[model samples]
Target: MKREIVLLAMFTMAIIFMAGCKQHGTPKPRGYYRIAFPEHDYKPFNKKSPYTFDLPVYTEVGDGAQPQTREKYWYNINYPNLNGILHISYKAVDNNLNEMLEDSRKLAYKHSVKADAIAERLFISADKNVYGTLFDIKGDAASPVQFYLTDSVRNFVRGSLYFNSVPNKDSLAPVIDFVKTDIVHLMETFEWKEMPKL
Candidate 1:
């Protein structure tokens, strides 16, 4: 009789264990995204002549998505390593250098609806004084954007995209830090020849 009872208890315990295991199935491990940058590679500046620089291998350039707009030059660069797309744009705001500078400044750091925008300063280079500002929007609507620009005569600029899934700005600190130096390198390497009159 004791042997029979022991066998029954063991079966009951096994069943309970199996049920519990199913009830709390082990979770698939979360993905860990490490920061991996590609070896430097690049092509000559497409729009401007007399400038050359290297960008990461994985980066790609494409025609700007918006064409009907008034912007002069617009290009899209996909940075897969960063899981985002960056937009490089140029537009003649007012044809005045000072006005352009002011507009860029406003785009960098003004956010009120009535105002232009808001950007967080990330890095600045000494030689070209290239500065970076992160433009962050809020909500499920859209995380925000990142844009770095220079008032240099040729109107050079660069930008990057983030996954938007996790955008603490703190979490993005690593890539932002890495790319800022790259941006400065690009700015310093920048050279623009006067466009020949048509």
Candidate 2:
């Protein structure tokens, strides 16, 4: 009788355990946290510089934070909440327009090893005298976007976007898209300040 009782209990426990775990376990895929992006808005950049543009309200402009002495008119448009920055460098055309254009191309193409592809788009505004190329770099490379704006006569400027964190294209796609719009806006509103007559 005792043996039968023990056998019955063992059977009952086995049945309960089997019923509790009826389904097979499956692994869950990894996911990234959702980011709440802010509304896109712009205000005219109010700094003393050779050129002017409408910058996103979410940014603050400051001198470049480099170890070496920074050049005049070189500034950084900082994205405080996003941990990103747009480095802006200005140069007088000085009859070296070809050299400057080549340099910009080299700078953008340097990331091509890590980048999947790079798209070059021409930007021209005869009214504003802003003519240059905008490079949209794709992949897990640094400086996903870079551009050079120049009147092709007197003023030339270059801008590059970078983030403080590691470059993860999958995770950063949304933020990158968000910031790309602002860069386009800056380009759209770019205008060179009138030079004083010598």
Candidate 3:
């Protein structure tokens, strides 16, 4: 009887081991929170700013927060849901167009230490007489996008995009791609609202 009991216990242990072997546990793959993107719709930024562009419906235009931005026609395009801001600084192109252009280049390149790559795309709209360069910065940079628009005579506007959260290229990839499209739309529709006097 004792021998039968031992045999029964061994059989039960064998069944349990076989059952456990049939199913394997795996660690869940790392993941990020699912993002709900807004529909793409834009309205004209018809405010009294020196320039005008079509702004995405999701954004709000407000005065810039930097001290240097004060009284400089600087503005911030705030994304409430995305927790991002696009800083726009407008400067009249007196005789400092060269300086402004160089400054913009410098600002965009400042992220080179953290960025894997920096791409410059030339923008030209001969009919509107608006020309500029858009800087697309990739990797873990603080600012992922920077651009400058100029009539090459009267107006120069520089813009940089920054997220309110920590910079994580992998996690922010989707949001970055989405916002990049909006920035391109803004640039494509950009125009000088006021003509310079001769």
Candidate 4:
């Protein structure tokens, strides 16, 4: 009888333990996540850095890499380390500068639609209203170059680029800010292709 009672008690205890083990509601997994960013070992542009701020040597000015339709005219600077590319262009818009800024927000959303992460990105305020885009390897290879369009006769400019990876916005903030500084420098140095001096 005692043996039978002990077995019964054990069974009851097991039942209670199992019941407790069974999650009452939705159970979450157990694990820790780590987010690590690389160290910043960058160099400034070799040519006269018409603009301020030091750009990474991993970045280099390249020939017109973007197609013609992208904008009237645009150029690219390769960011090989980050496996990224920065494409910049100028396009005249019918609307004014304010309207362009509003539209820029829409453009960013449109670009993010196809990407996985927002990546390091932001707006250009140090100089003018130049919309910027940075990407992280999220999906099939995407154009790392961000395209910006402006109507401000005072400063009609557009800039775009693609990041090597689908970068998280929070993590890339510093880098993006640094890139923006260079872009501002680019704007200052921006000289419309000499129109044959006609």
Candidate whose TM-score is highest: 3
**TM-scores for the candidates:** 0.54, 0.87, 0.88, 0.43
lDDT of 4 by residue, 1-198 (tens): 999999999999999999998977877875433434354445544432112224545477775535645433445677655456776544454457677665655555565655565554443443533334333323332442344433244334455656666555544444555565555555443443222211
- Which pairs of residues collide in candidate 2? none
- Estimate, for each residue in 1-198, the C-alpha lDDT of model 1 and write its tens digit: 999999999999999998888875578975556777655555555654222345555677677646567454566666666766666665432356566556655654443443233435555554644444445433221224555555444445555444535544545656655655555555445543443321
Give the total clashing residue pairs for model 3.
Answer: 0
Candidate number with the higher lDDT (1 or 4): 1
Candidate 3, residue 27: the lDDT equals 91
lDDT for position 100 in model 4: 68
Q: Pairing residues by index, what is the TM-score of model 3?
A: 0.88
- State the lDDT of candidate 2 residue by residue for 1-198, as single tens digits: 999999999999999999989978899987887989899999999887888999999899998736586566888999999999999998877899999999999999999999999999999999988998899999998899999999988888999999998998988889999999999999999998876332
C-alpha lDDT score of every prediction, in listed order: 0.53, 0.91, 0.91, 0.50
Off by over 4 Å in 1: 1-32, 41-43, 47-53, 92-95, 111-166, 196-198
Give candidate 4's TM-score.
Answer: 0.43
* Decreasing TM-score order of the candidates: 3, 2, 1, 4
The parts of candidate 3 lying over 4 Å away from their true place are 11-25, 65-69, 195-198
Model 4 has how many clashing residue pairs?
15
